[model samples]
Target: MLVISGAVQAGLAGIPGQSAELGISLTVMGSALAAAGWLLTVGWRFTRKLPKPASDIPQVEQGIRITPNIIRVVVIGAVLIVLASALFIPQVGFPDAFPILGMLVGFLWSVAAGLACTGRVMKTGRVMKNSADLYARWLSRR
Candidate 1:
């Protein structure tokens, strides 16, 4: 994500005028979307390498999972993204900055908090290991 963000910043560097900035932003948006698609594809391929069940069916692995040391990163990232986006919005749109700032902050709160909590949950070895073990069992059965 940081790498992609850096690429976006590089893409937007020194572009003058709203029209130019808008075009650059669109390009960055498209590129990021494409990259997300590619990443998802890669993740799918990676999970596919595991063994399959003899029954020729895929089974879902149902379990709780957790991770640690992610909340701070997420909060920091949220603040950064919100700050960057809010800074861009007034330049991009002619609206009052307060409403935009509020909106951005609200979005940041939700996504950052959600992601951080999710990551923290996944960090718990017992939960993630159990999930992986279940998945492995299903794969082997296949």
Candidate 2:
């Protein structure tokens, strides 16, 4: 809606002496529309019930497992991609030195995500083993 209103505002900009008022009105309307959209989305989310926890998955071990080394490699590869993108933003590009800021930011975030997944994997493995023990005990009771 904001984009549509912005285009309409631009089309109307040619009118003599109405540009200032038009700009002000469009800004207010655009801001209000954005706020209402945000409110609706958040309100809708609030109405939904939370699902079961991760442990509710039956026999997690039977599901596919991600090797830790692959996660590390993918993170490094993504950071490299970010560096390449930042260096070649122009159409006729003169490749510049690596962007330290962008690379550093990407590396930090990717590492954080990788570490989080690693921890989760370790915990899930422990939980899977423990759940098997419970299954064994349940079988013995029958």
Candidate 3:
């Protein structure tokens, strides 16, 4: 979406007096991407289950210790603020470039959120592996 919007914005720039139209279209696309990113972050966090505690599984405790959701929220919030400012401030940079900046900010925020979620999944996978090993050991003893 970001690439498509950027290409369209660039294409529109070649024409005379299409600045306003391009800005409007880019703003709409940026807003949509930002909203979608926000929703996906929320959904991802909510859907994830915290790793179960296991006395013999240090990896489980390690996995449950980090809270990436807070980091995600702060990063996304900053991106949103910047995006809004870019769209509305009217003096941050070139008048024709604000929309592109907004879209880029939104896309970056989405990427950051995805990275955070991936980190979380990796942590959980480590915890699960630890738990499985512990379980297998207990079963063998019995």
Candidate 4:
């Protein structure tokens, strides 16, 4: 959605007197992208299925181990920075350049966030598969 909106905004950039419209589009798209990023990060973390413990460690001991997800943190942070920078689109001194830059930044950031999410999902899926396989092997050995 954001990518499409950015493309539309880019197309509208050639028209004169569209700075206001462009600015409005930039603001809306930026906010939407930021919100989506936040939701994606939260949803991903909340919905993630943890791999089953491979050892006989107690639940309390397992809960104390914290594995940081650096990719998610970086992606969310970049999206936020893009969102913040986007707020200045309307205030740019040159109206003509606003749309182009805004479109570029918005589109790029949206893509980055999307790819990050995809990678994380794939990684999680792989882990889940491996854990299932391990459990199946253990059952077979029983």
Give the Cα error of residue 68 in candidate 1, in Å. Answer: 7.3
**Models ranked on lDDT:** 3, 4, 2, 1
Q: Which candidate model has the greater TM-score, 2 or 4?
A: 4
Candidate 2 error regions (>4 Å): 1-65, 91-115, 118-121, 136-142
TM-score per prediction, in order, is: 0.32, 0.32, 0.35, 0.34
The CA lDDT at 52 in model 2 is 29
Q: What tens-digit string does per-residue lDDT give for candidate 3 at 86-105?
A: 67766634455645554555
**Residue 11 of model 3, lDDT score:** 56
Give per-residue CA lDDT, model 4, range 52-110, as digits (tens).
53443343233223212444454566567556656765655556654565565556566
Which candidate should be chosen as best, given TM-score against the real structure?
Answer: 3
> How does model 3 score by TM-score?
0.35
Tens-place lDDT per residue, model 1, 1-142, is 3333433444444332212343345446757887888898997767747543233112111212222234455567768876786676676463334333433444445555666555544445334335556778776787
Which window of 10 residues has the lowest lDDT sum in candidate 2? 94-103
Pairs that collide in candidate 3 are none
lDDT of every predicted structure (CA atoms): 0.49, 0.52, 0.59, 0.56
- Residues 1-142 of candidate 2: C-alpha lDDT, one tens digit per residue: 3434444444444433234444446557767887888898996667655332346444444332444555566667767776677666663332221232333444445565755676577656665546656766666786
User: How far off is residue 86 in model 3, in Å?
Assistant: 4.3
Candidate 4 Cα deviation (angstroms), residue 123: 3.7
Error of 2 at 110 (Å): 6.4
